[model samples]
Target: MSVSTPSSRPSASSSASPSVADLVAATPADRNRVVDLLRGAAILVVCLGHWLMAGVHVDGAGELRRTGLLGIATWTHPLTWVLQVMPVFFLVGGYANAISWRGARARGTTYGGWLRARLRRLTIPLLPLMLFWAAVAPLASALGVDGGTLRIASMASLVPTWFLAVYLLVVALTPLTLALWERCGWWSVLGGAAVAGLVDLVSVGGDLLAVGFCNYLFVWGTVHQLGYAWRDGALPGAAHRLGLAAVGLVGLLLLVGVGPYGVSMVGVGGHGVDNSYPARVTLLFLGLLQAGVVTALEPALARFAARPRVWAATVLVNARIMTVYLWHLTALGIVVGLSLALGGVGLHLQPGTGTWWATRPLWFAVLAATTALLVTLLGRLEQPAPDPRPAPPAVLPVAALLATCAGLAVMADLGIADADGTVNAWLPWVPLVAAVALGTVRLPAVRRRGDRSAPGGYLAP
Candidate 1:
């Protein structure tokens, strides 16, 4: 196959189907249409995966119960390996950030300016969602919901947030990482991978489990570095993409077969030891596989994405991504709650039963409809505003980024709110919205010529 050099200039071809070249031409010069498509695709896949993986049931007591679908069918662990797309997300994120960061520096955009812009895109639409939960949590508690259930309910709504927290950190560190990449070169990536490998080794060794959490920085940081490699043209052409994919597949086989990691990338039942949660050594390989597949397919996918209908669909999906991701489980919970209250479906089927297997489609359908309603009501905030607005002080943006990370980290440790909706238990919820408001402040708006208000187009989505 011919080497794929993404052209800076749009194609001059007048073909019937809009080519990737035409799509780039239609975009602002700095925008990479391929990266946008990849981000868009990853968002859709993740939302769908969540919907499919949710395991909801009504118990004999008519109370709603929720569990992971993978936990329900342990034998299906291998499927998680295919569906796991977090690696793809970080890979695209790294590539987009590297590109955006370089462009920002060229245009003299400051760390605060670039970061504020990106975080604003992320959190602006999240305000109403946070406020809704805040108000509802107290109300739900007043209605006599149990503390444990309420905690689970609150946490369920925001599980997607842990990812954002980590990603925001990645965004904050991009300037520094790229600078390191320049001097130390690929060694920066090797250093990260070595650390991640060590963390995995130690975690499995039955001691120093707490140290493994560091992979949230190093493992993902390394994957992000791979993105840098892509952005800088260090890994171009069909051969490189294919080779990476081949190696990743081989490495994955060895890791699962010869190493201690499970077959499931998301891990099974009691242990989350795979490519998913804290991330493991296999994720580096998974990143390679995902990035390779995406890169190799870019030439074809770009053309397909360039078609007007396809482009519109992708745009619509991306516009509501944060909303969809944040509210999906809430919708599922609503459905489960209603099902329990209604009782016709309560305790009707057991896990691993033939009847339960037939209902998965129906369960998914209800979730899809409920999520759609929520998105319809809340999606506008997520839409990219056509106008570029003024931004607050550099300190505010920095605070916002760090603040949200803190909130998300706490949420990771605790739920968004506790039973009775105690203010202190949920204090961490404050930053998710506060950060956006700070970053979104209209402070003497400024911009260069040929400016576009495309959010991720500027800082990568």
Candidate 2:
């Protein structure tokens, strides 16, 4: 929206080369603060969307409103543009990965080990949450709680769960991709776009599953590369950042205006599309728009973050981010379940001619009240710190436990194996995957022995 470019930007990557380590180490706490703010903002956006779509409204006599905007939107469509902050999360994630990887490299850590560590940190605490949920799934189901509600609850959890897997895949590969970005610079990113565009075209005629994964790397990676630019001061000028925003806006318009993309950034249920699906180039465009805004707003964000109180608040939010993310739906489910059990309101709100839209204010109040309670009670899991000392070898024990839990969860979802030793149904591995993936990352510091760095260390600031 702002078109004027500022004077006094730094050199572009093409004109100058900085070691990745230098880039990582040079990232200011102010810059990290901006990222934290963005991340916190993303969580809030998601929560708002959930809050808007969620509810338990009782009429004068206490009955569920059958037809309402909230009901229609909740099951079919989400507040897409608002909820689309998911891309922002991933884009910032890219930046985080770049900084962390560069820092690990500087500290002489192997790429694999560095990646593994990142994975562990991102995922470890998720284990207890998963086990808790898994242990409860059957209990809730067996209690004759509404099966439909259970399914909806389970499905809602799946949306965020995929991100953990997708992000792992992205972080694991950043070393190689960033290397290309270093060598070919912008062209490397362009190459990725070209591939994604072509794949999208092909998907018009045939299945695009394999081709779509290209986006998970390219679109997200390009946004991550923006972090490198931010660190290097390549985007120092306001004009350039604004230009990025313009490009993103244009991208969004093109996708929504002419393309097969929906205006709702998040997935629309009955309308089709797991919009979060990489197949749609619209998401890439959204990432562009988000990255653009973040870069442009960085200076102001930096200034805002300068306040110690603000920074402390942001740090507190950052500490709870994962917990908040993993448990948000649980919070929603709690509200929904409790409200239903209380027999205060049926699951659905009173549906009038867009009447739920009018009741949104009320729905938001309840969502906020319940979410606060859930966060206060369940947010502790996200605050775990990696163990500084080397842990005694427990590979066998750990693996066995993981296996036991995973098997139990899966078996619960799908009755025991068939007589032919065939598992009849595909059990959701997300909870298990979340545990193992995160647990692996949380393993104690196994410094390559030749090198010593702080535990949970990234590149020096």
**Collision count of model 1:** 0
Error of 2 at 67 (Å): 8.7
Model 1 segments beyond 4 Å from truth? 1-32, 271-275, 344-348, 384-393, 417-425, 436-461
The sequence of per-residue lDDT tens digits that candidate 2 reaches over residues 201-234 is 7764477566765665566666666655565566
Highest TM-score scorer: 1
TM-score per candidate, in order? 0.83, 0.74
Query: Candidate 2: TM-score?
Result: 0.74
**Candidate 2: C-alpha lDDT:** 0.56
